[model samples]
Target: MMRMRRKVLCLDWDKRTVRLLVARVGSGRMTLEDAHAHRIPAEVNTDDPAALGGVIAAAMAAHRIRRRDVIVDVPRDKSVIARLPLPPTPIAELPDVVRFQAVKELPFPVEDAALDFVTLTADAERKTATEVLLAAVRKDVLGRIRETCAAAGLRPARIGLRPYANLVSVMHLPGMAERRVLFVDVGPALTEINVVHGGRLAFTRAANVSVPVLGDDDRWQSSRLVVVGGGGEQDAISGAIHDLVVEVVRSLQAYRATESNVVIDNVIVAGHTGVETELAQALEKRLALVTDLFDPTLPLGITGDRGAELRGFSAVLGLAWGLSTRGLLELDFLNPKRVVRRSETIIRRARLLGMAATAAAVGAAALTWSAYRAKAAELADVRKGMEDLRRVVRDARDLTNRSAEWDEWQYDAVWLDHLMILSRALPGPGREVIIRSLVCDSSSSSIRVDLIATNRERVKQFVDVLADLRAGGLPDEPQDSSRPKLYRVEQGSWVEGNTAEPGFSGSTQVMLRVVDVEEFHSPAAVNARKAERERFAREF
Candidate 1:
């Protein structure tokens, strides 16, 4: 089927203004149709959905954007982003695995956040492992965005990260993917920095640095012509520029610390603060790297006086372009991809099969009735046998009363002693071994322990110590000398750690069976236990 042509409206906003871009996307092509920026009055509260949506709606109407569906962006500062190095895992299992790791690093609870991720290129040192870029936003934030959109009479088709969008627009340029580049998007209240390596986003951060917004008409003028209210405003602009440069340097340092071998080839400053030229010059001078202002119109072939204004629309343009070309974005919180567990699929299939079985059983009801008639005589005979068995059960109950006496003398599992034994088996605290959980089952006479260590060797060492304790008698007070083995290692295995930082550690779960050596040695107790086991086995 031929795909329908779509009119894409991309929207993003800051405290000061709401920016909108409209594009025609289809037929193997995407072209920018129009772009506009609507300023929000100082008195209006951006957090109020009704107030913000009115401004957004006005901007859309002025830009002639009739489409209600829009692709929105969540700024870097408004969301949480993390780079996680996970063990080798199948693509089908990535969603669960990513969530498992992301929750540990997220500032907010996973239950309250919307999550999405995209796999990045593997690290050279760990070729078999998968590296993922995880993104999360609080549900409250998304709820507000949806409310604002609803008030503006728009439906949010997808929500994307602004830093990634900026990176995407830059990567669209000729020969950009092959080179290591730093993308700096200077916004009114925040500046986002993204590092691209091997055509993938490697690092991203947002700094609190607000650029001074000059006149609406003179967006692309040089810094020399920027005349603010007074010298204080000018000093504030200069200070903000300096702070932005410092943040860029810090971001570069942070990225290098994580990836020591990477060398940034160039930097691209994008935004329409009118002082981008000066900011780019300052960055280039400070960082000693090639830095230039990002011009969006040149690549899209946008001519006329509007080219300068389009510079600020890089993120929105990228969001539109990516969604248009690719049916789905790599990371979209609105419709994040998730893996369906095999058990859930099986349950669905079982429901259908059950329906079929019910139909078959209904058809066999006549035969069942005939069989019931034939079994009537047999049922009477079984009832007579049950009466006879009842008498025998009465006799057994007398013997059970005697066995109950031995049960009182039987050695019960004392969890406190077992805990002490486990403590002795495990290494001391501050040894890089953390016991996440320890569950004791007195009925089963087993202790299950979950532990995480700094490395696989430590986990294995801990398991070996546990096994040794199971083989030898436990050390307890008063009876410590001749006490028989009180534990038997039933199950143990190590797995790659999902919570390990820097990814070279593992975790292990050990199941140990608790033994009452004293009870086993007592003949009466042994006989009683043996009888109970036999009875259980027979019943099962």
Candidate 2:
């Protein structure tokens, strides 16, 4: 199937004239169909889009060009152009990194500007940094251009920088890729200089220099020099040409200072200001480099009466042809290409949402764990305080018990009553039994007695008598009526026979409990104490 051809209207303007071209692009080939230049009326305000667009609309109508979608060029002075050197980076990440760096270089706030860039050097194998051409224009400036196009009943498809357009147009010339060339486009008020190195734009700058034209009212005609046989006109033209040359030389010095190894081999000049011939000769003589006038329509076989007039149309022609051949130039401020977000795709968006949810859950779990640990620490502290209080209460109760026991000691017969009980348990005048040791502890309320006897039978008899006295079974002796009565005997009392020595065949030890005689002398108390001792003895 034959591809349908698309027609594009290219528009560019300055304070003097509005330049327009219509081209039909199809099957990778672009043909210029029509071209026209509309000179602004001296009374019409060029700054007003409504007034300027009326001239553009009338020009389009007069040229018989009906293409509505146009590609526009912003003058070099209207946009800020910069060449940024960046670290070696991948193509996918270049846009973001370039924008980040471009923000720092811009004179105005980035938010109010439209930005775009093209990478000039992106060789990963060279291990060298990447260089990109960055272009930014204020949104308000572009808005005015859009308003102008709209007023002309045209829709702007792309807004591109004029310097890059000139660069693209010049690169199409034969043998420009391998050599470094300085491209100069001289305008009435502003002149643009572009440095093309290795088929890429390296540097660009605009200067404020005006070229004098003889016929100021000659609308849409080639600019001609006024030689009225007068030195006054000649001197003024020569002075303007000299100023243009000086600006070109300064631009060359700047480019060379930065890239000393890359020497500019040729100077290509493009302008309709009839002085291009004079300017090229001056640059060649002053800078000592080959210089030539750039005719953009020549390569496309566009010549004849219209070719000379189209010398100044190189930037607009390049803007149209570059879009046709390359689909889209690297720099497109109308709709700039940016990094694609993963969240733009549904599957990637779902994954990102899942990751966010997982992070939130983990954070909540961490907070909950921290709260639990804090509460646990507080509970432990409370338990410790309770335990300390319990210890203090126990100590106070122990002190009370010790004080009551001390008071009992003052009223009771101290150790004398205990000695009397032990004497009564002895066999009369050492008849086969001998007392060995007697110990009494008033604080603990107990007595321990040790005895030696001739045989185990004598030891048994002495223990039996002590037990009987504690139970009140033995009759009190008449001589000791004032002695305290025996109240208790401990079940721990026992006798063991020792046959290791011939003199002592057995040994005995008895343990007795001291108590208040009046308090425990009742029959019921005595019987209750006897039952407890018997039960203990039986268990032992």
Predicted candidate 1 versus true structure: per-residue lDDT over 1-540, tens digit per residue: 113346788898887767788787764456787777666777879999999998888766655678988899899988999888888877777888988998799998999999998888455554444878899999999999999999999999999888888877877776786889999988878888999866578899999887777664322222113223222277877888899988999999999999888888989988866667789999999989999778766667666455556767778888877876664357788988698555445445555555654555565556576765555544554555555555555555556656765554333435665676677666644467777789987556678888777776766666666555522344322233344555667545667758554443777777877656334445796687679857854642
Q: Which segments of candidate 2 are over 4 A away from where they belong?
A: 124-129, 218-232, 304-306, 341-346, 355-540
Best by lDDT: 1
Per-residue C-alpha lDDT of model 2 across residues 310-360, encoded as one tens digit per residue: 778888888877876665456788987687542234344444555654555
Candidate 2 global lDDT = 0.72
Residue 151 Cα positional deviation in candidate 1, in Å, after optimal superposition: 1.4
Report, for every candidate in turn, its global Cα lDDT versus the true structure.
0.73, 0.72
| lDDT, residue 339, model 1 | 84
